[model samples]
Target: MTEMRLTPLQYMERVAAHFGTAPHAVFVSTFGCQQNEADSERLCGMAHAMGYADAATEEEADLILINTCAIREHAELKVLSYLGTLKALKEKKPALLVGVCGCMPAQGHRVEQLKKSYPYVSFTLDPASLDKLPEVICTLLEGGRRRFVTGEENPPIAEGLPCARRVRHKAWVSIMYGCNNFCSYCIVPYVRGRERSRASGDILREVETLVADGCHDITLLGQNVNSYRGDCDFAALMEKIACLPGDFRLRFMTSHPKDVSDRLISVMAEHGDKIAPHFHLPLQSGSNDILARMNRRYTRERYLTTVGKLRAAMPHIALSTDIIVGFPGETEEDFNATLQVIEHVEFDMIYSFLYSPRKGTPAATMEAQVDAAARAARMERLLAVQNDIALRLATPYVDRTVRVLADARGKQEGILAGRTDTNRLVYFAAPEEMIGQFAYVKITRAEPFALRGELINPK
Candidate 1:
């Protein structure tokens, strides 16, 4: 007789039945990017399907899952520190199931360290092994040994997993997974695997459902969104979504300069109103020598040209960028060139980072590694420069009226927080009911990091 094969859903049912009438709770600790947040939603959804209630805090949880990031040393350190804190909780709850997944565990060294040092961690799964979560849970329920699942360098794309979205009006639809660009300074390709795009139909259906369900903001996510190759190209895919019948704003991120095409720019211009007028293009460094060493493949001039085209097409486009303060073989001239580019671009926002070496990446072993003090000094200067640019650019919007989505409750009482189409944070006084809805706001004041606004027509 042939052996039976059960799917993830069946495994979910098995776990749910194992819990029967008793209540179980799961606490999910997610660290890192927007992509990680999306993955957590799915994690929560799966846990629910397995009959685990969402625990408000770790103390109340029967199971704890830590979704980690391995992009930089800082994030990894944070995750490690967090895990140590969980040890006390695990000690108190002897039977608590603890799992760590995502990029960090995908690395062999990290997995071995967890196995040796963190025995309380019942299992570890990489992004590729995410779908096997229920099966792992079932095995644990049977009192099996510890499990460590290292995902393949290049794995197949998994689709149709249930996601318990934390936000009611905002959604992140991962259009593609993994990356092909092996940037010398990047660990993404190593941990997350090679690039693989979802079918165009799958993406369209997901967007359609979100729009039908009152989703007001949808972001298409990818390692390099512009490099998406589905039934349609990235530009064509955006056009299709933009044309969908909905009152929603579309956005994407982390575009590779080398992949930004003329068609993409044209499509964005055509759907400028439907698509948010904000682009997050990362310019790691402005020095050609540094870029060459980093294997970015696009020169400083090319990045500027792309930025020029984006602005030319949409005059009011808000440009944000990622900048690494120091890189291997960087000199004062290279750093100055970066500052010069920042000045030339006058980016609305800059996500600046001090370079952190990852063991497996080429940049880790390169000569002339920037000193910690030098990196810190350069980061300070970079922020000072960008702060001035940001203030100057933000001040002009003080008297402007803009559309904003009331996404969250503000830090203060009687306040609602929202973001404008250009991705500017706006705070206004409004009812809690206003959350998940859109409204017109008249900016009364502008701060360095946000704008103070009032609802135009309070309802």
Candidate 2:
């Protein structure tokens, strides 16, 4: 996996000469999802390989790269605003290189207009061109003005590609790339391109290497992980990874409600020792009418059926979800129906957002567009309801002993934090040495968001 697909000989020589002086400092400001964070890690790893050191701040860095997100309009705006601020920095220091990557550059106009708007900006790369980072930076440093390393789709690299992982024990393994389901409101399929899953052998080999390297918690990442059609199906991939010799806990994210199958649930049930029971099946809207309009391809009943199966397979499983409150043409009944689904599902946590239309999406032009004020109110209402639901669902875990993979240090004195198999954040009093290890913890206090716990003897 470390063997790169592309290597320009001239760029390599230039980077070597550039590195002969001092290591270039790189500051990567990552925005959006886990996938982006994972991409950032690879970006850093590539930078590191090219003799770049980590920069503590944007100002201190020789290169300032914003790993952008375009999921919502606000996210995109934030990146643009930041880029505007960087104009001063780029102007002040002629050598200070500014680059943009991720979904923002993938958007057509953003890149086209960026060339004129911010000539100080050194380069713009799309999400697929992550591996090209080394060359991009080298090219920029070598004083070549050919900006925008895009249009050429980056082929899938092997899984063990070196990454400057943010966490010592937790790692993100992207089993697949892109999306096939073009939900009316989504721009992922357009920006990220069609589904291209990584090879199974590469994934497993990566996992094995990670486990050997003291990383034990692994999250399989994708736009829609469940729809993975690599060398094997998603379920089969899980089974293979779960069987691998390791002390690792496995997790996957952002499953499309339509693609999560019974076999996946059964695999989770079978591999209780490894696979964590946290299902994040997004229910965009509960109303069938809205669901149809959104092109989710699954009704409320079908979604519920899958939920029931998951719960039946593992009742203690934490169910999180992505919810959009006010899509085009949504009504009172539609909003209420979403609330009903929230109540019916009793999700452990919810990542909710007010619907913001993307440029190329079908829903953007639809009639009866929701009022901005209504969308805000609906979002507030949805949060309030889900907050109560979260607390109610969390209440049962109080005083229970659960295995926690110590992952973070709590702000509270003498406490270390980790997550339950169900993905509940549990903070327990433990030494710093236990940060990368598993501990049995007895929950002492519970809230909607986290649990305070005391470490107990495993025996």
Candidate 3:
């Protein structure tokens, strides 16, 4: 595979010539986490800069990109299945270009497999090499058969990159890239590489620009956001972003329990009103034995203590978490311990998954393996228990007055949808003009997953 580089304009010219049009239509399908979503946005921005217009439908798109994820076996399979559909499209229109980019390509074996199986895919580019996308597209346009673009080198942190945002009021700001923590059951560290925080000045400038552009909410994205040590570290970054001039709100996710510090909690408390009162801390296992096996670096007791500290700092904070069920050698006692933690924490939301072994990870080669049927049963039971808790936690908010930033029009008549300060989805009846503004909403209904409210008055 030959590596190629081209300027943005030259890349656009090649694409336009290949498609026989100035504004070529492009469609992107993104999978996995928020980090992937942010990468997709940047990819779209690059395409837009290259004279490619957003396609209304896949059938109409001249170029289609599958921004993939390889966090789990199922996610990878889903991406491949999607690629199968695009195969027929490529056959019909030989000029139609298809590309696969993101974590899947970052892994050597997966890239080889993709090349062998999906010949319709024109190129494979890693997420970290986003700046090289124009060059990769240009190579494909120039009749390059196949190529894989990835390396250990950090690409330039290109600022002022144009983006076609999926939403108007909410924006995702990638403050950093990659992860350093190599948990035993995980593959993120291998795929995303080590933690590399963006400079504070770049992050602050991006946020300020979004604020000026009428973005009222921003989520600082990173693999392990709490580990972000820009100029001053995660705490300092939060303080600086919170103090920025705007009527905007701030939030972040996927905090490693080990990296979260008292100083960060204090910063959250100080800006509790401005910061969305939500935290998505991953607690993979509840048993200390399993925690150690998983290399989480924090025991169940330590995690609870950190939760306690956050609650004490911001009494009204809502908690969400990710839990992996049925890891290698997980006994009945270990599963029960996870259930107990769910009951105790009463998370606002829980992203639960049955552990699927990823081939290069340590857990895959471990001798112990839980039965598939048993894993499915355990996952169902865990979801049932967690859903009940989520409903209970959400019920109290019914009939309470909460502030919501109306982000979009709703499906129902004269309805609008937005998220609460705690990141709760709130649907309310409001006029269209109120779509990008904040308004007080009086909660009238509550569900396990969403809340219903009515607009009270403009702020």
Q: Estimate each model's TM-score.
A: 0.97, 0.94, 0.93
Q: Which 10 consecutive residues of model 2 have the lowest summed lDDT?
A: 1-10
Instruction: Assess the local accuracy of residue 121 in candidate 3 as a C-alpha lDDT between 0 and 100.
Output: 84
Please give the distance, in angstroms, between residue 161's alpha carbon in candidate 1 and its true position after superposition: 1.2
Cα lDDT of all candidates, in order?
0.90, 0.86, 0.86
Model 3 per-residue lDDT tens digits across residues 6-116:
566567666666656556788999999888898899889888877788998888997898899988989999998889888888889988888889999998888998889
lDDT of 2 by residue, 1-459 (tens): 223445633444557677886767889999999999989998787676666789998888888889999888889899989899898887778899888999889987989878988888888889877766667767566566747866555466534445898878989999888888999999888788878899899899888988998997999999899889888999999999999997889999879988888899999999999998888889989999999999999999999999999999998788998888899999999999999999998999888878888888999899999999999999999989988988888888888999998988889878888988889999888888888888899998889999988889631
Name model 3 segments beyond 4 Å from true: 1-21, 409-411
Each prediction's number of clashing residue pairs:
0, 0, 0
Residue 383 Cα positional deviation in candidate 2, in Å, after optimal superposition: 2.5
Q: Tell me how many residue pairs clash in candidate 1.
A: 0
By TM-score rank, best first, the candidates go 1, 2, 3
